[model samples]
Target: MNKPLAERLRPAKLEDYLSQQHLVGPNGSLQQALKVGIIPSLILWGPPGIGKTTLASIISKESNRPFYTLSAINSGVKDVREVIDKAKQSGGLFTQKNPILFIDEIHRFSKSQQDSLLGAVEKGWVTLIGATTENPSFEVIPALLSRCQVYILKPFSKEDLIKLLRRAISEDDIINKKSVTLKETEALLRLSGGDARKLLNIFELVVTTESTTSVEITNEMVLSKVQQNTVLYDKTGDQHYDIISAFIKSIRGSDPNGAVYWLARMIEGGEDVKFIARRLIISASEDIGNANPTALVIANNCFQAVTTIGYPESRIILSQCVTYLASSAKSNASYKAIGKAQQLVKQTGDLPVPLNLRNAPTQLMKEIGYGETYKYAHDYKGNFVEEEFLPDEIKGTTFYSPGESARETTIRKELKNKWGLKYNY
Candidate 1:
């Protein structure tokens, strides 16, 4: 009997794991700790198919620890206690050693289930390795979370996914013998959306279905295969990234028609309407700042409406927001300003706060010249007084260059009127 694709390809060691070089690479925190035989209780947080389970297995193997497993989806408090009892019995083998208890989908475990494991973990009877696709801050109880170090696993990069596909074709027992030619891989990679398991599954389906020895995987073939199969639209997986990408690009390209079309795709795919609305809210600020400040307000209101009302009715609210945002004049001045300001901060190190601008909460600071040279803008005419606000090391450093748009034109004119050559770049 052939094992499942996911099972066959699971990385059994750190060397076999594909991405997360920052964590599992040589000299990485996890790798170093494993070498020294000091494995901390940890929580692996990431989206599915990014190899969280594989990492947990690798940790247990490399450390030579007795490993026990549980699933939050199926395991209850009774199961947790059973595992804890087993771990306690196993810990007696060595004076200093304890068993490693790994819990998959730990986010699904209820408060009581998690509470049951606290005593075992606190006593060092077991080193808990918890994996969750959800944010651990919200799902994992504070007490349990505080006991474990959380490591965030990023989605696999394009190169990483490609590497895995090549490995599956060349290394896997089932597909290795068959000759396959990857004519076009962008569509496959894009469709997979950085999910290694999904990439391999799709590859298996494509290669197995074809009759010819040398198979060509094309964009059309991929689309056809996906369409033929049950359209499993994962809100937290590939479809989430793809739909959101299309939605953002539509607004950026100023095509309300395309924007609304993607919006419909997401809605039809059973996407969480609130998730769609949340992305729109972000697009308003990041992609559509200043040019239409009202866009943010409208997007916020749409998000609120979607939260209060759901389903078929919320689609209308989302449509109104998507269209308005796509049609609005767009600028990223505020976003750009922050980016530039952050870069400046990193470049110049920390500069002393200007004396006049410093708050004189204490008499000692006031006597030394805090607020000494300050001039009240409101006290002056038109609430206009130009003085240095930046640190002394970099005074009058211009960061925000307003983009040319109807909305920003007024801002540019006002800036020129007030600061003249000081800010007129």
Candidate 2:
């Protein structure tokens, strides 16, 4: 059997691994854990071709544990139990050397399928190492998620990808048998989109097909050999991220036509409805915000509606929400305000709340004058009162600057009327 370059070059040991130095470096927590022969249940979350599966295999080998594999794409609840039973028999229950069960694309597993894993993992029957390209918080059930430590694997850096190409050239038996020099890598790197597996596959494709014994790689040659454009949407690949970004940017730019076009692309590609709805909700809040609070309400309703109603019918609801958000007046004041406030908090390091802001539930607290100077806003004119609401050290610090949209203009006027430049409105 002929093995692909990616599989042929899979690192069997930690020393041979590339990229993710943060997770596999000397002072890294994961590396430290492996040093002591303590392997905890962990979820490797990141993009495709980033060595999640290879790392799992390395962990199992380094720990000297029985290894089992499953793909959430095909496996079911019954398949999970069968594997758990086999692992239990092989390693015994709650033993120090428990089996390692690696599940790929774990996000595809339904709630019931994930539920079946709860007992075995909790009891230490198998040390679970699941891999996902999606956010585990949204896919993994809370019960199962809480049991595993989530370690994120980042996309391969430019330096790391170059290192992979060099290693493959110098180490691989088939490639080294011929003379090959990497003169340029811009086309290869751009085509791979920071995916190590894709890089290796492209590199191998470019190298092995050369007719001459001596081969020199260049950007032009790489592009000539491989198709430069793709019309099909790969929901799991780079297109997935790129399209979603285009979709949200269109909404933020207030281009309803562009928003609907990207929405149609995703829909035609059979993209997950829940994923589309989630992005709409985020865009409504982060982009539209108080300029049209109704945008958020509509986006949230769209999520619930699409979740309950799957594809073919849910597309209509999504189009409605997308167009509404794209046409709405935009404001990022709330988003920017929170960002500035968070930076201030980090700089200030948790200043104490003002005395009046503290609760005076107990008489003992009341004796200390917790609410002595606290004014009741309703007791004053216009149902408002002026008081120091911020910490003494950070008083009069303004964070919110309302946007110039119609709704926010009204808000700015109201603030100017009430505080009289106290907030510099």
Candidate 3:
């Protein structure tokens, strides 16, 4: 039997590895460390199919270090200790080389399970390389996290993915035999959502079912294949990306019907309810910003309610949020405002802050005009005052432009009354 395309194409050397140029490229931190023949205890934080495991294997092979693996999901404290004991025996006292222990899904490990490896890691019996989809700060114990350097792996870009597809077509034993023409790669790429493993699987599926080598793959064919395959909802894979995209777009398009439909798809597919809820909360802030402030409050409440009540019942909480956010007025004014402000700061460099807005904790700062012309808005009628708060270079520059929505109408009115043409109200 042939190996899976993802497994077959897994890079065995640093040169074969794609993406993550920052880590494995020339003069990169990992590449530099490899040149010195010193491997640090580290964590690979990223989405699935980005080569965390493959990178660990390459590191161990290239460095000539003994390698051990433990799954945080299935391995216990005893398994951890046994691996440590074996590593110590292999290293001995005089040996400079240490075994590399790679823990997959390290976030799933309990506090006690993680604690078991701390001693071995601290003693240098083994170099720890942990992989996780979650933020290490929240999932990993502080003591263990502090000892290991965390390297983030980004999703593959379109070019990187196209390169992988080309490589698979020419290199893979099974795939190379098949003559296939990729007529439309957008559907395949969109379906895979930057996951190489998922991409290859879909490619293989499409080719295997076709009668000829020169078969053209279409979006319809891809959809039919995916619908037939009823695989588990891999929260770390394509499904996660697809569902979230649908959810966000549904709210953005103001289609409560579509939003609820995607929400149901996620729920029926057994997606992590919390994960869906978290996306909803982010969507509220990002897509529904300012236009409907209540959207965020409701989304946040839905997240809390889903956490308190799990499964079957939580679907209702999710539905309420999806519908409410979809029907509400939508705007990204706050989000765009921050982006504009950030760009201005970068282009203008760090302009000196207005003296009136600066703190005057010391007498020297006050003598330099710090807080000298500051206006206290609270001391004025209706807590309103026209004062120059921005840096002198950007005194009247406007960042936020309120959208033409009901909630923002009030904001537009207030700004028009206060700053008038300064804000182009």
lDDT, candidate 2, 1-425, per-residue tens: 66989899999999899978899999877899889987889999998789999999999998899999999978999999999999999997757799999999898788899999999999999999999988999989999999999999988889999999999999999888789999999988988877788788888878887899898999998887776433311444546677889999999999999999999989987676778999999999999999999999999999999888887999999999999999999999999999999999999998998889888999999999787889999999999989999999988888988899999999999988988878978
Instruction: Kindly list the per-residue Cα lDDT of model 3 for residues 279-377, writing each as its tens digit.
Output: 888889888899988899999899889877878999998999999999988998888899999999999998988888899999999898999999999
TM-score-based ranking: 2, 3, 1
Model 1 Cα lDDT, one tens digit per residue, 1-425: 77766679888879988889889999788999888888889999998789988898899889888999998868999999999999998885333468899999897777799999898888898999999877788678999999999999998888888788788887888886788777889878877777777878777887877887778889899878877774543543457677779889999888999999999888877665656887898899988898889999999999989877888999999999999999989898889899999999899988888899999999999999999899999999999899888886776678887888888888888888888887644
The 10-residue segment with the lowest total lDDT in model 2: 228-237
Query: In model 2, where do residues sit more than 4 Å from their true spots?
Result: 228-235, 267-272
Highest-scoring model, TM-score: 2
Clashing pairs in 3: 179-213
- The total of clashing pairs for model 1 equals 0
* Model 3 score (lDDT): 0.86
Model 2 clash pairs?
Answer: none
Ranking by lDDT: 2, 3, 1
Query: 408 in model 1: Cα distance from truth in Å?
Result: 3.9
- Give all candidates' CA lDDT scores: 0.85, 0.90, 0.86
